[model samples]
Target chain A: MAKTITQEFTKGLWDEIPPFRLVLGLCPVLAVTKSVENGLGMGVAVVFVLVCSNMLVSLLRNIIPSKVRIACFIVIIATFVIVVELLMQAYAYPLFLKLGIFIPLIVVNCVVLGRAEAFAYKNGPVRSIVDGFGIGIGFTISLTALGALREVFGSGTFFGMSVFGPSFQPFTFMVEAPGAFVCLGLMLSLMNLAGNK
Target chain B: MVDNNMVDTNKFIVSHAPFWHDGSKISTRNYNIALAALPAILLGIIFYGMPAVGVISLSISSAIIWEFVFRRVTKRSNTIGDGSAAIIGMLFGMLLPATAPWWLVILGTFVAVVIGKQIYGGIGANPFNPVVVAIAILMISWKDLFDFNEALMNYDFDFAMVYPLAALKHFGVSAVDSFNAGDLLMGKQSGGIGSTFGLGLIAGGIYLIIRGIIRWEIALSFLAGVFITALIFNMTDSARYAGPVIHLFAGYTLIGAFFLATEDSSSPVNFIPMLIYGVGAGFLTVLIRNIGVYVDGVIFAILIMNLTSPLLDKIKPKAIGKAA
Candidate 1:
């Protein structure tokens, strides 16, 4: 309880980075990370949802009955997800099409729900907002890193630009479903290695 | 559990009763398996010439290098001395087309050594054969590269002698007459570098069995499964299915039966489980070849059976005096 607000914020970046460290919200991590753009887009959307939900949840934490806390949390998270989905449709139609049902499914994302129950419900709104941004940015970084690795090898491209040139044959397997798991595993181990030091 | 007298005791005073070490090391077993595979490899090199030798050597060397680098990076104890990487490399090379490109060979070995073997805790801990894993992934990624007929078309060959499996799959049983059983057995067929020569595979398989390096039950029962299934289909509708002999000689059938299916650790250990694994792989191989979308089913079939081997191991006999 004596921990500073900065410590709470910084923990999400490395000490408890989602997907790689905390290992939460893997549904979006594995599903939408076929390319770097998709990863970034998905990451930014989650950031919006997480920050809003966290601030709202922290403010209502004292009012909502403990028995109905989960139901209340879902309602808060679902509203933010709808805002994200509609905003994506208006501003980024192509990316929205690429991410599809995954944007709506963010309501069920464990990382958002986990932070709501574990962090926001216990902390002040200011700290909760900071925690959401920190964790949301961490999720974005992990997703982008995974997507970059897969895109470079799997498609021989980076953000639609060819990195390996014309002659390079894409390792098609890296873009497929199994490649996502393999990439996720390798990156997880690497994160653990860095964390160990 | 009470069997201890069967241990081959030396003249010296022995402390252990039930333990049996045939004075064989892991390296020795690896070397023996490598030696057994030599006849087929040599035949492949003779037929395909320099390209064949290049693929074999590159795959073997790269496989070793990958294992050594991975171990060094992870700071695990050096296991390259055991010769398992060499065996994996050799088997993978033999399975590839002689014309396989340089990058594909390097990448395939990386997949085999790193993803397939070391990632699963190295050597005996892998759930599926390393060679099979690489092949299956490569097969999924690059279907065109594996099409033998297309890949090897430039070589001096008769078009009439089409890839036996593709021919049968596309043209039906009428294409069977174009193939000679004797030619297929003697390495006159078109296929993977070492997989074409049926006689050499049989020789290598027999060597492995005789050395007691691999259990004969798995290999023979696998062949039996292929033969029986193919035979049953041949009798029921000869027009639709090729005969049992072609099923045994063509594509990856013989190699899958003898080498790939018999990989240690991934395969069942007990007697009954071994039989079931072998037969199941063989049955699926034929089933896939006849009806499935793929031209040859040996690798996929063996991989599927490898998945089932752990569950099949549970089918062992109950302990004496224990409740059922």
Candidate 2:
């Protein structure tokens, strides 16, 4: 039983990584991942929401009826999203402005609700929290890597520091909408290649 | 028994479709295209001087290198000997300013060969012309680099310094009068290295058409489309829109009509679809020039048409001896 719980916790890291492997929650993945700062902020927010929602959903599992489970799960998830939104607004006002509607839209992020329905609803509170953390961390890693790549190539900077010399002409396509799709596609291909090996 | 064994061995020799050889080879086609482009390329060198030569050489070498490296990395067969990479590099170089930076040439060729061609599984498989794709991306990403006015600012010319397309785009039709149709045809205008030589490009295009290297239908229809569309716009508002002759001789129109639009594997194989694709591209080019933000619409227009090529190729005439 202990081994199964541990397996659930670790699966989200590789077996079911949100953005890379599972391809879940792509809206924020593409939107806020233009820079490392925004990606990190969004990733942290998602982790907070996922952990809280998963724990609360697990705690109320027996009381919530199965037929209305999705509805109840959404309410629980929305509550946590709002908490993260308000906290970020109060603490990180600039990031809140940058992230804009995306933070509020986290209520609809499939990853959070998916975890609640698929894992938290039937699992114990501790296992649910671990699962949420693993998935959230994996998502954060992917976002940061994508953001770093875009920033370095698109603007010749890394985490706001100039990495290349002044002579470097940034390939601005790396930051545009098409660039986002191409970058994500190339990353996905690399992941697939690695998996095959 | 010896006769029977020989017949069985001959029967065992398997072959695919197209068993009949027409004596056409990819290398032959590529070399012919290079030969056809010589006049315009020579004119570019004469007008732009050594920098033009440098850009062209670097573009060709870098394109070939990129394809070679990509094939090596992907463990695919080496394709550098076919000369398609050289042709792509040359075409891409022709589209750039004579004063293009070395890095831009290298990067543009990389985009043309690797992202534009190899990523789509290499030559003959790409849905769009590789050169067009690279040029479009460069134009979008670094508009300033492609802006002939700034890129060629250091050079002195007997004619007006402003590129004809830019002048028409920014200052209206009146600004284009500085360049007459004769001068534009004679390659006296300010533009890309090879695109300015209208007469040379037309001659090259005609040579290719004669050699059966490209379809004349596409080239003729594209020009016709441009002429008719520009004529309408000129009639509507002569003060706002330049005439058809100016439109044809101004930008990448000639090069695009002959070399870029008729790129095999991205163009239609049927008669009606070919006409439609060419006319559509020419129409969009004029439309984008007159109203859209870009100064010249050749690249975008060709790309748009290329996107519709697959769908248009479906409009086939009924096959002979087949039910309608």
Candidate 3:
């Protein structure tokens, strides 16, 4: 039984990663992942929201009615998202500004609400927390990787520091909106190829 | 054994559709295209000097190399023998200025071969013209590189150094009067390396049409569309818009009508769709030249038309045996 629970936790990390596997919560993935810093900030905020919302939803699962479950899930998720938004505004204002509407937009992010309905509502508190951590961390890794790739290629910088020689002409396209889609698509294809092998 | 052999000979052979041999291969078509483009290319080389040769050669070799390497990596059959890469290289090089840098040529060919063609499954599978895709990306990325006036700044010409399109764009129609109709036709004006050779382009276009390599309908309708649209615009405001003749002779008008707009994979196949597609591209080219940000609208115009090719191809005439 414990092994099965552990499987549920680890599955989100690779077996069912949010962005690459399930393709959930692409709004934040595509929106704020222009730089490593922004991606990290967004990732941590999502983690906080996911873990909290998942736990709370699991705790109240027995008491909550099945018919209005989606509304309940939304309220719970929105509360956490607001909390993350305010905390970021207070503590990390630069990142808060960078993230812009996406922080508030996380209220509707499918990942959080998806976890609440799909896993947390049926699972116990501890398992739900584990699942949230796994999924959140998975999302963080993917976002950070995408950010790093775009940043290094687009600007010849990683984390705002020059990684390439001065002669290196930045690919500039990788950081633009079209570049975002192309980068994500190539990454998805690479992941599929790797997974198949 | 003899009885078995006789029985095997009597069995019908199962083969895929297109059993009839037309003797048309990709290599034959590509080689013909290369031949068709030679006049403009030679004219460009004569006018632009050694740099034109360098850009053209590098672009061709690099495109072929990129395609070869991609096929090797993907474990697909080598398609470099078909000469499509060379044609793409030639077309892309024609669109570039003689002053184009080596790095820009390499980058453009890489984009044309790898990103534009191979990534979409190569050759006939690509929805867009590989050269147009590369040129569009390059234009967007490095606007100054493609700016004929800026790129050709070093050269001291006997005539005005100003590219006619740029002159028309910035200084109204009267500014283009400096470029005589005869000179523009003879390729004395400044523009893209091969595109400026209006007479050569027309001859090459005519040759391709005669050989039946490209449909006469597309080339004619495209030019007609441009002529009619430019004439309308010229009539509306003679002071602002250049005449249809000037529009035809200058910029990428001639080359685009012949080569870029008729790329097989990205263009319509049927009769009505071909006319509509060609006309639409020609009309859009004039519209963009008049109003859009880009100086020459041919690249974007053809790309826009390429997007509509699938939809235009859907406009088929009724089949003869269909239920009434």
Among these predictions, the greatest lDDT belongs to 1
TM-scores of all candidate predictions against the true structure = 0.94, 0.90, 0.91
Model 1 misplacement above 4 A: B1-23, B157-161
Predicted candidate 3 versus true structure: per-residue lDDT over B221-305, tens digit per residue: 8898899999999999998889898878889899999998988778888899899988998899899998787788888999999
User: Cα miss at B236, model 1 (Å)?
Assistant: 2.9
Q: What is the interface RMSD of candidate 3, in Å?
A: 1.9
Ranking under TM-score, best-scoring first?
1, 3, 2
lDDT of 1: 0.89
lDDT by candidate, in order shown:
0.89, 0.87, 0.86
Ranking by lDDT: 1, 2, 3
B34-143: candidate 2 lDDT, tens digit per residue: 98888999999998899999999999999999989988876677888888899999999999999999988998998889878887677666888999999998888889
CA deviation > 4 Å runs, candidate 2: A1-11, A165-169, B1-23, B321-324
Judged by whole-model lDDT over C-alpha atoms, candidate 3 comes out at 0.86
Candidate 1 or 3, higher TM-score? 1
- Which pairs, if any, clash in model 1? none
Could you report the DockQ of all the candidates, in the order they appear?
A: 0.65, 0.46, 0.40
lDDT tens digits by residue: candidate 1, B81-111: 8888999999999999998999999999999
Best by TM-score: 1
Chain A only: list TM-scores of all candidates: 0.98, 0.96, 0.96
Write out the backbone clash pairs for model 3. none
